[model samples]
Target: MVDIRPDWQLLIDGGKKDSDGDGQRAVVNPATGEEVATVQEGTAADVDHAVEAARNAFEEWSDTSSEERARRLYAIADRIDDHFDELAEIATLENGKPKNQSGNDVFTAVETFRYYAGATDKFYGDVVENSKDELKLKVFEPYGVVGVVIPWNWPPMHTADFISVALATGNTVVLKPAPQTPMSSIRMVELMLDVLPDGAVNVVPGGVEPGVALTNHEDVDMVAFTGHDVTGEAVMKSAAENINPVMLELGGKNAAIVFDDADLEKAVSGAILNAFYNSGQSCASIERLLLHEDIFDDFLAAFLPAIEELNVGEGMDPNSQVGPIIDEAQYDKIQSAIDGAVDGGAEIAAKAESPTDEHLAGGHWVPPTVLTNVDPSMPIMNEEVFGPVLSVTSFRNDDDAVEIANDVEYGLTGGIWTSNLERAHRVAARLETGMVGVNRPSFVSLGLPFGGYKRSGIGRKRDLTETMREYVRVKSIQIDHTDARYSLDLDLAEQRTY
Candidate 1:
């Protein structure tokens, strides 16, 4: 096992390692269903301790110069680049993402650090001239200590999303990494400790207890969470008690719309890549496809054949295009989603063959599948499956496509594929999602804002400058140097002067 010490590890404190006296849990490899590592099953007490440490160090760290913070962030990025391969392998083994995707995820952390490094001073304030007598100066200041809770899909990238920018804006952190994939985050924080203060960043790896504790802690200034919608509700309630602000990134069931005049090849390629990437574990995955009635049959004919060509194998295999489900709960969830859809009259148009290798027998494997005849009201089309399952339906025109796409409770993202530039622009503006790609189904820009309307999330993420603002609070400092008389409705100034 990678982290075999039961008594030695359970919590990572600043630059020190300690045990919570709780216990240890085995980290299973999704590809082989084997124990590949072990991590501490930290308790609530550990979370409290971590938060205390962060609070203690917040003042000094936040007071440091922006240039000094930028220098330290760059050092962390350099360390990540030096050990990219090792971190990627650990992530692949635990998260069941293909090797290349794992590498990209790991590199994403490097990019995030470097991106925010240059943005340490980006959260600029403004000086407003209300009148010559009174001037207002607004400044952005960091929230003392931020509590971050991340999901298991993309640990490396999410670590950067929730932590890197928080640090850039000068907030200390207490991260509760996802239980299923905490090793990589723990490793990432280890690198941060090398360049940051002892209590500037901390990680407590465990199941639900640590997350609950971190969110509920009164000392935490802000909370950033990424996970299921149901769980997000609980976090919101917990933070309510302390009256702390929260940034919730609940997953979504997004849609991809294809028009009759669209380029079939491009639509098919985008659909496959987005639907099956990381076994559809991402919030941006297009869970449903809305095609125009005129081209429904033709699009399916091209898409079905492409879906059948997907390869499912070990995550570490260089040639493997797909990997196993993250765990048993998710495997069962996907299977149930598919079976329920079929029973409800949905037809399976295409299904890739399951892994035939005897070694992967115990792995949580789900075949890449395509479903048709699914009604808009069906749970498979409404609920976030978060699996390699895509449902198809047809729309009449641009208006019809926008209606169907906006019908769901989630407005995280959507795609509109068409050759007509007017329709692309027209329909894109009408969709309810926060971000959209005119011709690309699953396209995302690292520099643009990413979040959703409705239940998908609260607040935005990415674009270093904007995210820097999320971790800070704006303070208005107004100066009054005027001795001149001012217009007052109540005329109370004369009475006060007397």
Candidate 2:
């Protein structure tokens, strides 16, 4: 196993390593309820130092050519690839995701950086043809400094989502990783320092104090945050103080709709994977599954058995498909939601058996739960469970399915399963979500724009071209091409009169 000691330090001004003045905090392992490591808690003062360092580095870094930036990004990606196994082990230990899933997270992060690196030369501004006598050029300039606050659910992958675009577009960054899973981010920054200039990438690991300080700082030009909606609102308010633009990826109550004519086995597998993946800690988890009345019974018969067969244990166990919840609070939330749903007349279709191992008695483990006869209005159906609990409800027809899927505050992701191409296209158009999967589950790709529609989020995340645009400011330059320098002759006389 990778070293689980607490010797990590904050990365400031790219290569400078320093200890936080605020005392240390323990990073707990949710799988075993033990302190995996200890990290220094960054305070408001540390945030100021980080921002100042980033601001100082912005002038030179932003002026560097896109080709050089791309080279540096590729180097970072290579470094990550070299240490992929160690990083994945750290992620699984801290984030409580299964080993394979954590490895996927690392691979995704590496690929994301490489994707942005390849697009460095392709993100170009436009030129408008307004008039023959004047030349109009649109240019994209990097924001001086950007603050990125990443959540713990997807540490390595989410950090890469913002950091790659920001650095590739020539913007310096001050990142604040979640306190729970700071080791991987710290290690990432450490590796990046070999190629990145000082202050080009800095990290402050802590809780609300550092996050608020970073968001409200005067020097930060923009903020990119991914977390719950409640905290997202606060980040927005803080950003508004300086009129700084903020990109938010908030919570979601995603749904998967299964039509009668769809492939039953495919739909069942998609729903199970979408619902229980990462123990349902993902924002795009399909907490609500709307099945057609004609196929509801058949869907459950297949879905329940699959969910029951899933293994739940420690993340390091190769056989474990589902791991423990992140912490006590998350475990309690999952329990409360499940109990509340059952109390509201929802029947439990399937629930996995808890591990009987004596060592796992104190772990924050929750079994995979599938609930049927769920009312669409129930809190478990409408609210984001953020756990391995899938609530199934029946819809009469296509219109009913659309209505049920769209009747929620979140519009992040939805799935449509059907054999009829026309019906799939029609229903996909009606579902109010940022992304829809026709025959499969919703997933992120290199070039696709990923974000939510309604209260789910504020801006997009993926797509190298689109993401680079968000971190930069656009400027339109107009030049007078004509040789004639005709100032109105009458203007002299009019100026004297005025």
Candidate 3:
């Protein structure tokens, strides 16, 4: 059993501090609607301190050898693995995700760090041959400091995603986690400091004040954010004032296309998982389901039963397959979306009954919901529900499927389920999403770049090589081997002759 703390302090420069006397906010567990912990609510002053510390540490940290950086990253990964259960418990308690899912989040984080650790020595710049007398080289260098803002849904995983790559590329970071779920991130940064130098990683837990300060700070060279689209746009706007580069992984209204030739069982199972995982809080969650006309009925026959069978209760329970929403605001948003869909003439194809357990009565729970006859213009179809609500529509052909899938403003992730190899490639080529799973519901690995295309987001993450490129600036150097006076004289003579 892990010890639940009543209060946690902010981490800055390898030590804990109060939030500049700004006081604290209660961190509630959605599973029980109880205050699991209280964390310092950092202010703009705290943000300034964190950024200054990171800026001060950047020089020495960036100057470290790549091999040494790799060793430290590996050490951090090992420590995460050593304390996996403890971290997972904290994650579940604060984020309201299942114990098993939290464990997987930590596991993915460890692997992500390890993956970037190996790339430390493999990342290289280019040396091109321009002329015999001169040599041209392109060298990569780290941006002095990075400001990272992570969402509450996937705190540890997203935290690791940005910090690991930023640190691996020799960029110090000042991270601001979502106010609702800050303890897990605080603890993760604390563990990271054991291997990293002071100020290499700092955490300022707050709502919007610290984020605004971090993005608009003159010393912060770049900003990486993962959250709602509106907040992401605000972050971009603030960073633009200082001409800082911003990497955003914003909201997604993803779709899944199922063809007649697809495996019914596989498609149904994958679709259910895609729609309901993390209680459907993922940015890449499949909120829209596009089914071919021929397979719509068959798909629903197998899909409804599975969605109905999903168990929803406390995340800590070993038997619970789905957990409560992150907070009351999110729960209300999801409920409103469902009500709006029903009022818009959409039919509820399948909806899981609320849990009967008396202990879970106060929790913010939304059963796995599936809607059919959903029009493309419905808000549930166009907007991001960010819940276990799936809005389904049918397509008569490939063209119709493509049109429906690309109808939304978001192009983050999509799924294509088909047995026809030619059809799969052709359809995938036409889909506007940044990432597509051909036969699988989700396809995310360490090496592949994960990001969105349209309004969903800007830039990518996950791939070590690509992530490093984003965190660094390039400089082109040319060495002149020929005598400058002789060259100038020759040029003048040639000009006179002309």
Candidate 4:
């Protein structure tokens, strides 16, 4: 078992590591089904202290100059770069991400921080055109304290993305990491404290209690969350009592549509990546593969072999391309979904093999699985399996493909595999999703805004003045050139609307 580092968890009021009578929880390694370390769990009371700390620090931190803030944010990015290798390893061991994918998450964290840092001085409000008597303008201001809740998948990257945007927009934060993967996330908050001011960012590591406390806190001006839809619903409902805003990026049952004219090689490659990356634990993965009838057999001929070649084993293996499911419960859930589908007549078209080593026997391994003869109404097809599982369905034409793609409740993201530019644009426009990738999968980055439609999610995550828009509140100011009460300019009887 990996040892615990006392300095790396349960921080409140800036860099102070504080805990109440609540005990620690075991952090598990999904690859071996063993305890990696124990992290202090922050209780509801800890959230109160963190919120208070953030409130006390908000004004001073928000008042800092933009240039200085940029410098400090850049410093945090530099620190992430310095620890990139270490963070990658830590995340892999804890979260069961393949080595390469873990590194990608960390690298994206660096990019996220730098992206928002460069954008510090770039956010702008608007000037209103009005009559000559008065000057009217709008300005953006930060929500004093933001409550952030992130998921277990891609912990470091999600932590970096959410917190950087909040701090960049001059908001103080109270962050809560998922119970499944808290070590690296708390370590990340520790690194940020080295550069950011005390209390500017605080982290509480725990299960549901801390998250509920943070979201329901009256002092938190806004709440940002990324997770499953059920939890997001609770968060939104709780925060509504105070009428504070919420930014929710929830789950997805994304689709990948392959047209008849698609480049088979490229389509197959992207489909493979989408179906199996991070053991298909990504919300943006192609949960459903809709293929043109003309290319259905041809695509599977190439796609099935690729799935078999992917290595499913320990995360640290240099050759490993797939990792275990996050835990036993999730493992069983995915298995049940597959079993139920098969019992309901869905056939297992192909499945990859996991490492046969006895040490890996304890791991919650989910081989890359593909299901054929699946009905759109099947639970596996409609619900989010969130495992290395793919279901294939054939479409006769464009309209059928779009209908099948849009059939699910989730519209987080989808892709079109076609070489024709016009068809790509036309179909992409028709698809129901927040983002689409033509001929390839879209990468979540600093440039493109990320979110979903319908039950998928609530808001976008990007550095656009628009993604930056949600982090801030707008206030309008009016200045009258004449310093008069203006009672003479208006007649009460004429102005009255009976």
The root-mean-square deviation over C-alpha atoms between each candidate and the true structure, in angstroms, is 2.9, 3.2, 2.0, 2.4
Pairs in steric clash, model 1: none
Local accuracy of candidate 1 as per-residue lDDT tens digits, 39-108: 8777888888888889888888999999998998899999998989888988998898898999999888
State which candidate, 3 or 4, has the greater lDDT: 3
Q: Model 3, stretches more than 4 Å misplaced? A: 130-132, 486-498
Model 3 per-residue lDDT tens digits across residues 301-350: 88998888898877799888889999889999999999999998999999
In TM-score terms, candidate 2 sits at 0.96
Question: Cα lDDT for residue 129, model 4?
Answer: 49
lDDT assessment of candidate 2: 0.89
- Each model's TM-score? 0.95, 0.96, 0.97, 0.96
* Weakest 10 consecutive residues of candidate 3 by summed lDDT: 485-494
Order the candidates by lDDT, highest first. 3, 2, 4, 1
> Which residue pairs of candidate 3 clash?
none
Cα deviation at 91, candidate 3, in Å, is 0.7
Q: Write the per-residue lDDT of candidate 2 for residues 1-498, one digit (tens) a residue.
A: 987666678889866466658567788888888888888878889999899999999988988898998899999999999999999999999988899999999999999999999999999888886687988999999988999999999999998999999998889999999988999898888899879878888999989889999999998999999999999999999999999999999989998989999999988888888889999999988988888999888888888888888999988999989999998888999999999989999999998877778877878988899898788889998888899998888999988999999999999999998999999989889988988988888755668989988888888877966677788899999999788677556566555854
Point out the worst 10-residue segment of candidate 1 by lDDT.
1-10
Global lDDT for candidate 1? 0.86
Off by over 4 Å in 2: 130-132, 485-498
